[model samples]
Target chain A: MSGSPGAGRSRIVTWAVVGLCLGLAGALAWAMLDLPAPSTRLPGQVAAQLERSGVEHPVTAVLLNFRGYDTLLEIAVLLLALLGMLAAGVAPRASAPLGASSMLAALARALAPLMVLVAGYLLWAGAFRPGGAFQAGAVLAAAGVLLRLAGFLPAWTRPGAALRMALAAGFALFLAIAALGLTEGALLRYPEPSAGALILAIESGLTFSLGLILAGLFLAGPELPRREDGGGTP
Target chain B: MSLGLFYALLGGGLFALGLAGLILRPHLLAKIIGFNVMGSGAFLVLVGLGSRDGVADPVPQAMVLTGIVVAVAATALALALARRLLELSGDMVLPGERLRPGEDDDADA
Candidate 1:
């Protein structure tokens, strides 16, 4: 198939890349095989201090309490990514009007409220089981996406002051709490008595802000017009 | 080998595959997908290694959860950039990269 010089060179490059990947895989396998046992076990440590960490679920405890600094920075990173997207300077195209799909609209109407309820459950369940702000926020975002698809909500071009505030609320609250913790001798060190309540409050704010941010990631982008619709310039 | 080791090895394979895809693919969207594949492989490695001793470790699991949310955010930003490029240049491939003859036609299509 390499009939031309360019094709031959491309073939060679492909082979080299494949060879490099194989070597990487081999090296990784070798490293794993020769790995020494870790000196400290984190899971045990988490379990030992679970009582003081606030949440019953170990993962939740680690995320919202033990390593909360990471979560705080993560929320900041999410907001930054959204900000970058907004600053990319792509003009918002008009959203396509929904066709007569009453079934889809009805389905979205039925599911939206249910999804909101599920998100709430997930938020409440995070204290004891394998559910948390992230899952809850994701569900809420999915609902928003569905609503947009069903024509109940329109694509966002520019967010208003309230919307912007809503988007930043979670990160701001997290930072504030972390700052307040400085008075407690350490960053994010919640008072033991109110740790659960504090974590819950944080999760609730995160769920609200994260939901908007995640949905905005999709809805903020301009929708491409269909070619057959005569929307493109010749 | 233990289950954890097996998963770790699988993750290594996935990482290698994703690396190849990221390097070899010409389309920006494909490159983004390749990047996601690489991220997933790394997440698998992290959790697998942490639990190789048979105990479920919450630290790596929590980190992976955090990584997932960040990955979604990154993917969204990347997609927005790609769409902007498509709007401005009418193609998804970056400039200066030579497209195979048939690939150019595909891009126009």
Candidate 2:
């Protein structure tokens, strides 16, 4: 929290911080020096490339075909982080009720189902759009953040079997999908309707699993420790 | 390269700061926070590196994602070790208490 985080970080750390910021700025400048280069395309750019080459939807092409595996492991990382926090014995402190912020609560509650729907839509469109499990899950997780702030959910809940089940769902579903792929060819390869469907199925599990996992990791626990074991922390 | 490189640089700096915190923070709990911050910084760097021009590179991203998980695993293990150390000695060990482990573990909660 201090300039250097220690009791006395010294002039050295102060200089280090300044140096670090400058270095990062320099790197950014260096990267931008070669702007508009063929290798500096954004997500949309790659999609455009695929479209020129006959890909139906560039977004979908990139998400499903280009980096689907990355999407899968993103969920995995969320789960692992959640589990690690629990294992670390970092419990959440009790939260006061949402109290009079009914407006915020109402807004969040109204938004929850809608957000989930959007996440679902994104997952569905991952094969042909900018959205994917990551975006979807982050949205869902934000929903949880909303619910908590609204007093609809507890500040923190102890980790338990339910948590484990929820976290593991993505991995389990992925394995199942991979197995299905193997039935036709190698693991995770779909020889069916198209890449879109494959991505959709995977995205569904990913969205749900990752949303809860990341939310748990971020908001479900207290900065320090907590009381009860596991329960409806809400 | 532009955004990715930028984030990677920022992440790397944050990581070094966190590492210094981990080294300097005397309290056991604060140390954990430092470690978590370091973990986050590293994750950002990994994610940044995973980015590609036009195409999202799945391989590096996947590996980075897995690396985040693995880092969490190590963090958990370290926490467990810390907890045990605290329990045995009734006091949290300071970071610089390396040469004298048993001495500092005696502090009361």
Candidate 3:
């Protein structure tokens, strides 16, 4: 492969990349071994402040209360990524039922509602357990994908005004609450009395929107036309 | 070494491997997979290092959760862009590496 000078150069470049990465790995391992202990114990701090953070689960408390601004921006970033996809100009074609298997269709029909219920349960359980908006939203998105695969759901084309509103609602609500927190004292700082309710409200909106956005990421892409040589096989 | 430190070192190894794959792979999809691997490695390192003392740290865990979602979003965007490239060029390769007509581009390493 390296008979030509150009190929030799490519090989040299590959070697250089490999060498650099090996050095990086070595440095990282050395640093990890020699690192000083953290100046502050963050877990202790999080535990100490958990009572006032509005969630029984420390991770949830840290996510939606102590570091809510990050969550808020995260949703915005998701929305922006969806927007970037939409701007790529892959207009979806007219929907046709592609999944012809009766068993798959039947399974999707039976499971979609159950998946929604599971998503809801996860969102509700997040306050005190290992479940939350991200997990719930991912489950919801998976349901949507399953339905799409079963030909129960249509590919997203130009989303109507209602759909657009649904896509943005979570981020808008999050931003509005953050602004409200400014009046309360600082951004995203809820009153201790209503913190739980506020987080619940935010999570609910986020669940719906995040689900739609994640599903849209798959559904928004244009359906590739089938190649003559059977090139687009699944 | 503690379990957390061991995992941290493993994560570092994964990061290096992923970096190598990202740089060496010619296929856009493979590169995307490499990028995800790198992100996973970084997330593992963050959590592993934060918990090296044997106590679970909520802050880093929460941050990793956020990072996972962002990484998903970024992956979606990268895929969308790659699909566009494939559509426009009729090949899933970058412009600089594109082979001329009548030549087998996929034959090289």
Best by DockQ: 1
lDDT of 1 at A106: 78
Across A62-135, the per-residue lDDT of candidate 3 in tens digits comes to 98999998999999999999999888856444434365376776788789999999999999999999999999
In model 3, state the lDDT of residue B66: 95
Structural similarity to truth (TM-score) of each candidate = 0.93, 0.58, 0.91
lDDT of 2 by residue, B1-109 (tens): 4577567667776676676656654567667878888777777766665562434554445445445555644564566556646656655765445322232353233
How would you encode candidate 2's per-residue C-alpha lDDT over A89-150 as one tens digit per residue? 53222334344255765687679899889887876655554566767877888888777665
Candidate 3: which stretches are off by over 4 Å?
A: A91-97, A223-234, B99-109
Colliding pairs, model 3: none
Lowest-sum lDDT 10-residue window in model 3 chain A: A225-234
Native contact fraction per model: 0.84, 0.12, 0.86
Pick the lDDT winner. Answer: 1
**lDDT of each residue in A1-234, candidate 1, tens digit only:** 359998899889989999999999999999998999998988889999999988899999999999998999999999999998988857755445443266767788789999999999999999999999999999999999888776667566677799999999999998888788898999899988999999999999999999999999987855444324321221
lDDT of 1 by residue, B15-65 (tens): 999999888878898789999999989998988998898988999999999
Which of the predicted structures, 2 or 3, would earn the higher TM-score when compared with the native? 3
Cα lDDT tens digits, model 3, B18-105, are 9898878777887899999999999989999988999988999999999999999999999988888877777777877644232355
| Candidate 1 chain A minimal-lDDT segment of 10 residues | A225-234
